[model samples]
Target chain A: MTADRSSGPALAVVGATGAVGSVLLPILSQRADVWGDIRLIASARSAGRVLAVRGEEAEVLALTEDAFEGFGPGDVVIFLTPPEISAQWAPVVTTRGAVAVDQSAAFREDPEVPLVVPEVNAHAVRIRPRGIVAGPDCVTAAMIAAVGALHAEYALADLGVSSYQAASAAGRAGSEALRRQLSLVAGTDLGEKPGDVRRAVGEDTGPFAGPLALNVLPWSGELREGGWSSHELAVRAETRRILELPDLPVAVTCVQVPVLAGHSLTVRARFENRVDAAHAREILEGAPGVVLVDDPAAGEFPTPADAAGTDPAWVGRVRASLDDDHALEFFVCADNLRKGAALNATQISELIAGESA
Target chain B: MTADRSSGPALAVVGATGAVGSVLLPILSQRADVWGDIRLIASARSAGRVLAVRGEEAEVLALTEDAFEGFGPGDVVIFLTPPEISAQWAPVVTTRGAVAVDQSAAFREDPEVPLVVPEVNAHAVRIRPRGIVAGPDCVTAAMIAAVGALHAEYALADLGVSSYQAASAAGRAGSEALRRQLSLVAGTDLGEKPGDVRRAVGEDTGPFAGPLALNVLPWSGELREGGWSSHELAVRAETRRILELPDLPVAVTCVQVPVLAGHSLTVRARFENRVDAAHAREILEGAPGVVLVDDPAAGEFPTPADAAGTDPAWVGRVRASLDDDHALEFFVCADNLRKGAALNATQISELIAGESA
Candidate 1:
């Protein structure tokens, strides 16, 4: 899918009023000017609402087939909507001769649609035969930049990851639910007894499986076979696909923590070759889209509080496994709304824009 | 190390005013009366305070050699003080002929002293050649009961763990810091930008390496060799010692979360034989110190909120690894104060009391 280069390619953003979209607008205004016209599109309920983009007020367009009438090959439409909406509208926009960069799971596993993280697999974006490119899940997007950097040096063979996912990964409702629950439990001695937090959080769990205030929920997305969550399986599948390791042994446990934004992960990677912490540090320090915050002696490890609005994956706590010299362990944090969602999609859109130019 | 059973063994409690000590007193009073007289002991600063144990107020005695003069061979003194205090006073209490059960890291690595998780290694308490017993760290204590039961069935060969440790793992001050930091950031939009939370929680991290309010600190305990935290190394060491798998390949990452009291762990265990989720559930259900809460279809997995004031290790989210049939993945939660500290120590004291009887 090529865009006409008469002028810079136009960009259409669906779900522009959402959590990720709200973060995307300010980012679009701040980054290099690569778009001719930026269109803000949303559901009927949100249509006509004025949103600021590129320092100008733009009215949100309702989601209809007419919304893509004038879009052409050089234009790009980004979908930050839920999977169902993206699945329904991405093809409509693509059929109108524009490229669709989707941040939904609808077509991520589709072999024809490339799952692109520009830093790790920019080349994958060039071969999107379906005219749609899928963005990786927030959890995968948050860590792949750093993990890809390490894989280039160590030839990763096995992966074990435990996530400390923030509430924002579930979108606006998740974040509001956590804030409301925290407000209900704050200044009270609530967490010391069984079901106290649950009772305090009655029926306001938002989109989560249980109360997320003063708690960590081990489940994310719907339950799958063998008791795995859809989000957990998505992480395993997407990571293998992006890393191009078809048979990598991947085990993941996804957990939802109480943070309002920024997702953190504890990663254990075993490579085919022997690896050490110092060399891993050197690799991460030089990798693009990765920021090394190591130097624990100086209290400089990464945490969600520091990584919440950052663009790069903040990596630290790098160590060689005491039992296996082939294994390295590290901790990583990234703003789930930025690098994990909007930033990666914007980066992919830029890659497509350059191609059309 | 046997206690005298003239009537019932007298129990001496040290660090009576601290976090774990405060929890231990109530537990000792609620459980069966295994002690003839309960003696409260603390530092000179807290010597005059009165605390209730066994439903009676008792005057606290200052820690001095004279305090142990009346303690004899049938007495038990439980030390919940800091490592240095336990290292100093444990031998003194033992010299006076009372069995010392220490909940400090000072003697955990001592070959002469046994690390006892009463449910997993009750027999080890029988041969305390140094007349002192050590309790495992909170992380290890939180999950060992379930892991031990699974090990008995499949024979654990390798282990990997990532902990979602609560603030209380650092003691009362840790909990206070989180509550204070929460109050500072509560009802305010603080976590979205870089350093906003740290700025809001300026210089009051209290026993943590960073701001733990709305954040997950990956560094716990002092930074050790190769970027591993002391708490992380302790989990690996203590798990091996208690499981008696000295050469077991173990990797651990201890992270401090925003939760208050319960410590949760995601564990990956590879065993000698093939393990399945159903069979693992059966074993955990029958395990003495484990409570099975599997059944994710009904929102029935373990969380710190539900396990905070609980006695047993709440085990759930059990699944056999899709890649490695011999490996099983699961989540476990336990109250860091109860089973992780006080309850285990009290259980060991009761074992001694039964010996005298």
Candidate 2:
């Protein structure tokens, strides 16, 4: 599902008033090469707001170590903050040469960074030794983009996720504490016999210590002691280093529902040989950012309002787990703010502007 | 989770105004025991409404075929409709001899149907052959009440689930289509753009043909032209006829979350021997209606908002899934409106009233 590239780079969106940097500024202003000039930059409490570019508005500014001072090296910089503001503005905008493209977890498992997913391992961004470039965790980029399009067709072993995840990936204040605990269980006062005043308001919340509306918070990020949670070891070490399966065997379980932006998952995977569930639903009905809404009689698959705000990765319940004939069991839905975080940093800034065009 | 009951039978909820007969008439009038006179029935558009007993209010009669007329010959019914209204009210309430209990999926994979689960097959309901005593698809009775209390101290085989399910097990109009598609994505219009006005207001509802508010649907029921989905072969013939593993292989994936009740699962299981995930978390921390709530270094697992409206079955992300020493992974939530449907039909009507006391 490609094509739509109106033109090339010269960007910068850096935390431009948050939330997947305001959805990677109009999906890079709806890819209308609509000619260069982006530079939005934010914080200092979103410097003088105003956004909507190429049609008007624009002016946001602020952010500094001198908003990059001379700055102009911007030919792509993305990083929607936190990992301590992307470990300090990704080496001050890739040491001023630019091409940062992050989405924090502060440069995924570092080893000289390069997590890119311009369609899975966009040639592991020509081995980036820290002009940084990481970006995973949106349930490891929608389960390695449906396991790198099912490792390009049947060949994945040991993966068993269980993510539901949402509350805007714990942002926008955990989606306003799941819209004030589902507006206090839809104004529950169950005492007169509706639910016994919501079961005696048992377990309260303050941006989730529990009770996020109709609840579901299987402890997602930050819990590292041994109960594993840094969003389940960064989705089991980035789906085993982006499916190059360095000894695969991944079993993630990053919960956090009360969704407000879609992230649903329930994968099962497990193969090498007998993959049947009708050839794992014909290799996820011809893979690529998946869409196969499996039909089990007729409760059709894939939903998050059919993958809220498109950018595909919205599969459906594809079965075959009655015990495991090479286990398969699916269900996905993306849009964790567009293909999990500003469309993988604007498709890795279009493969870093197609390798510096 | 027993005692908590008193008196006994005179009960007959029979899908009494649905949704697990309105959480089984306030747990059969506050923690069960209906030993005489209590009927409820449904459908004449939920008859005369009103539901509650110990705390007053009862009237809701409609389901006929001579609505088990003035019961006297063995009064305990239960039924919860479907499988074509329990195959036309289980042989008309077990042929006038009233003993039903059926939760519909017809006679759950009938082998002369026993399918009970009063704590793992109440002596296969003393050989039910026709009195039609069935019940177990509330995710196979909260997953064999957590694998038959961890197969009563470790040793089981081949299993794998992937549910997340909710939307009130598709009833009470699929819990009002997940609370009116989560009030149509919390009352739509989330523009500053991200699924701008819900793909131009697409996703209207009806147990979902569209719109499930802040979404995630992945087929709940229907679909099975040999590609599984009567909620994945009722979790594989009710967990192989209640862990009597008739060729045990059970692979499920019945997801559908908007979180209006609980159901979460993410299992892996696999055994035959090996078993180590800290001795299957000390045999699921000493089983029984199971609880463990795993630790995963401390994000402390199990969720559906901590087993919403709890009644146990809560385990949590245990581990050892990856280098499978007999595989494990974890998580299993519960409360699909009380232990997946009115407290397992009020604990199989207190084990058919302590087996004829």
Candidate 3:
């Protein structure tokens, strides 16, 4: 283990040039009082790139064990890399005594690693026996925070959700690829015939199975066992873990929409007891970290355009289920980069720093 | 009443210059053996336009009482017009002794006017005592044809559905407006911030509350009492009517995606008995007007791109809900014009013509 540092926690941000990282740096700078000495680290190829943060320029450093050399027990190392990279480096950093907060699927299911959403399960962060705290996937992070508040008040029985995911959730390459296809088909009359848009955007489909310019794809993540898409399984697993509903009956169908930032979901949630829309709206309105924008007649409701770049989950369209007295239907949207990924990691990092202090 | 013609039933198409009409014309020509003389009729403003059908030019006639002058018993007039126009003209044609196949919501809820999805409830078409047969809405037409087949074998108790609707479901103006907004935002970096796309497409939000380019609107049709959009109400009402489940418990959340033609839905249905994926697939593969394309590893799934201009509802992503033995989840897609609107109306008209013959 590395020698302990008596000073306040420093932050080493791995994958500092990634899609979520780009958004993370800005948020960190805006919440500058949360830490001391922030280190920007990325792959060797992006090491020399300069990024602006809080009116200061920081040159990206190559990611390696040496990058965390000065990061001791009091310091926190945050990983925003893909699953493989996170798996490799999480133990590396935590072994050297610095707490590792992983934003990848690498260690999310690890029994010793605490899978956390600050607003939903901050207590889970304190029980990190492996010195590793794992944030939920982008979809789960947004959904859990929104519903966890309600779950805390009214015990949830089961959940049925359909997601409208944005392109940015696939990272920078995904957003760029979706934009390229949009530009290609935006000028043509490709939406008229079968496979027209798909043919027009051939090979530029980019991280998606079909053209998303004027379409929605019902699949996300790699195909997995039992015919579940990686995303479908992840959503079910992570949400179940974070909500502490070990055996919760959660049904999730993830669909990729053309939005570039926010991830939206339509939720039909059943509670242990009867729930009313007005009371539910009241709970959501007063709930911390959730914005209630559900006045439909006034044209106020959550949309990706309204939620992008925001930290709070925008909750709207609250109505009691027509057939069930104990259920409610609502819509939720959060900036996939902010609350869904970067901000949640930032929140977890701050929680660790507070504990150390 | 107009004089009864001994010649086989003449086919008259109202709203023959709209988006569904543009698709309906070709379908009618391809199925030319179903009719004798075909009359194209539209509002006065669209009269005199020459449209080609069955390799022959047909002049558009002004929609007036005289437009149906020679149409009588055994003759069928299909109304592909707006709900308001269908409401105004449906009784006029039916009173003149012509079977009026209305593809609008105006007559759908009327007990005498059967709302039919041909594959699901063709027998309901014969019970149109008011001489008016109404087809289901675009979203319902696509989904009912898919699920109703399964419901026939396994009784459905409740359904949870979320629709990913195409812009053309809003008709030509809606689609043109959506395409225009898409063109405006497709070239801009408008998705990174709140209201950026809305600002970029200022005042071009046309028919929809917000810009649909690279985004989705959670509400569709008019905002109704109890905060349910007209679409949400229509989906529940129509699905129940077509499936012959007068009190079937259905929860629907309709979101307008950016697709131009096909409407897709993710449905979770609770049945009266146990259901499995393999059996469901086998059932769907042989079900009339349903195409089973659920092999995900081979990347065979339904998207609007594949369903556009297709006649059958493409079913995919079938899985049994993990917690419920009686529940099944699946995704369905179909051309909103072909099966959703024009084709269903055409089918109903043919059924009426066949009975009269």
Candidate 4:
């Protein structure tokens, strides 16, 4: 099984039938032709299913220890599993000398695991002593590249972000739950009065704590003490780590909107020096992995629907902060399934491949 | 025409059948039993419709010059009409010696007309040289009380706010439009991909610039140059004026969410002195017109659904910025039809009654 080093790394995709995995398969087929054998691994129930990638059908393998029996040191495994699954499987892959690029939050804070956004901190990928490159949670990965680009030139001092996250951020189950809830309450006057929403969407709030169809829920992820949600805490930490601003003054409020795919954020950034809308727009338009769609008069700005299925983080509504000369306010949106989760993980794996070769 | 001054002033509600007026009439009846004659006036089409107030059916009258023909100095008028109607009729009422409390943006920036948020700047009500007091826009009025309360203690220097505005902020038509659009797209597999929303909600986006059923539209109000919406600019100006920080740095983004009644805001405030979340929570808890709900672990934070019929602005998610000791970040939600529009207007009228008596 010794292929030439130049033949490229063997890619193994764990949780290949999950939400991000479904999205990642198409992206992998479309973007990375450098992989030798693209292996798809899922739970036992999905193991016999065939998934189409790059115009070819790949049989999904059951994700057990025996599945990786053939995996070698030259292999790169991308995990799109739950935190518990990643916690169980990631070390096993890395122990077999394969690089594990995890999309779970399980190993993100580990000192030996390099939490990375390739565009923002590719250098961190090379320093992973645990052979693990942790992808940011979908919320942070959605906007950090664009935010990081601005911070690079402006010396970002503080960030205030309000996220309008999509249903798919919680994966396939979350999306299905929203769809089910929407069917129960849509076309009805559920939002007309207080408790009306509660009455209409009774006992069917789904994976979300509240009904998200025709409504916005201010809390996301697991609830933490002092009214903090785990998603908000993770976004703050991930963005801080990716931008290398460990003490970055970042206040994030994660609110789940009814969008199915893209995650949208309204960001207020304070810089060390004055920044104008024109200069910010110029920088954003030319920034890597960022698309600036800002012409308000033409009714042009990024929305979750507009950013859905897109790879780049779309930035718009760029304005100079009227209250602070050093601050810039803008909106950012990206596909939660794409750049926000799967693509970023794939990019990290590609970085490892380039380095190992 | 004035009987005993102890009997209280006459109250006329122009545009009484409109969305804000409908909400205001109920609040007026509930809060102000002092008003003598509560007149309900609307356009000819709605003139004959009877609306219930204070447990009685009040007959709506046509909003004509003749409607105010008997109005005198001892009378107080509340204008919940659109800006155009307010511009035409607010001056007419003032000329007839009646104090006009306008909820519309018609007189907000007029030098002689003081824009009043009673809890924040009630003294401004007595200084109305034009015989008119203006109320803040629904968006600003919803959150200013909480922000103002904190500012009174800490000297707020800068503000960044992102508003999660509801459909009713655009009036009854806006709410109806959202309902219709939601019926068309919700639970229908519309928001799964880019442009899927547009394709599904075709030609039914209504008063909104885009489909607002399950999607969050970043643009609100009429578009302005440099991508600022009119609502954002109005909030900035009104907030600065009410807080008496004439040059206060304010950056606002008004986003239309799918909620029906409550308008929510995420505010980041920088003060002149360091403020902690615990201290901020204490001030917010005792602040007039604010209900502090900060226990996130019990899912106790406010959402639009929770604030739908409430009078007070619900405040929560209070967190002191880790980067700036002087800055505080929090979330606020209020009934857009109540505190945002009608109740503030009603509060201003009560001020006129107490002074004129």
- Complex DockQ per candidate: 0.86, 0.17, 0.77, 0.66
Error of 2 at A6 (Å): 36
Write candidate 4's Cα lDDT for A229-292 as tens digits: 7888888888888888888878888988877888989998889978988998988988888999
The ten-residue window of minimal lDDT in model 4 chain B covers B1-10
Residues B1-357, model 3: lDDT tens digits: 333345567889999999889999999878845677889999999999999877789899998898888787888999999889998998899898888999988987898888987788888887878888889888888888768988988999999999998888888878888889878888678788987888888976778877888777898878887678888988899988888899999999999888888999999999998898889889999888999998888777899888998899999999888888899989999999999989998888888888867
Please identify model 1 stretches exceeding 4 Å from their true place: A1-6, B1-6
Candidate 4 ranges with C-alpha deviation above 4 Å: A1-7, A223-226, B1-6
lDDT of each structure?
A: 0.91, 0.69, 0.87, 0.85
lDDT per residue for candidate 2 within A1-357, as digits (tens), equals 111224544676778787777677777767645335566778888788889866667777777766655443436677788889888877887786766878878878887887777777788876776677887878778757776776666778777777887787767777766665555454332211223323544545555556555656677666664355677878788778776777887777777766677787777787886666676667767776777776645555566655666787867666565555666767777877888888887777777677756
Q: Candidate 1 or 4, higher DockQ?
A: 1
Model 4, span B1-357: residue lDDT tens = 232334678888999988888788778768847787777889999988998887888889898877776677867889988889999998888899899999888899898999998899999998878888899999899899999999999998888888888998888889898878777776576786889888877866778888887678899888776678888999999998999899998899888887788888888898998898898999999999999988777767888888898889999989877667888889898998888888888888888888766
Per-model TM against the reference: 0.98, 0.38, 0.98, 0.96
* Angstrom error at residue A38, model 4: 1.2
Q: Relative to the unseen true structure, what is the Cα RMSD of model 2?
A: 19.0
TM-score of B-chain for each predicted structure, in order: 0.97, 0.36, 0.97, 0.96
Query: Measured by TM-score, how close is model 4 to the native structure?
Result: 0.96
Candidate 3 chain B lDDT trough over 10 residues, lowest sum: B1-10
What's model 3's lDDT at B263? Answer: 92
> Which is the leading candidate under lDDT?
1
Query: Cα deviation in Å at residue B121, candidate 4?
Result: 1.8
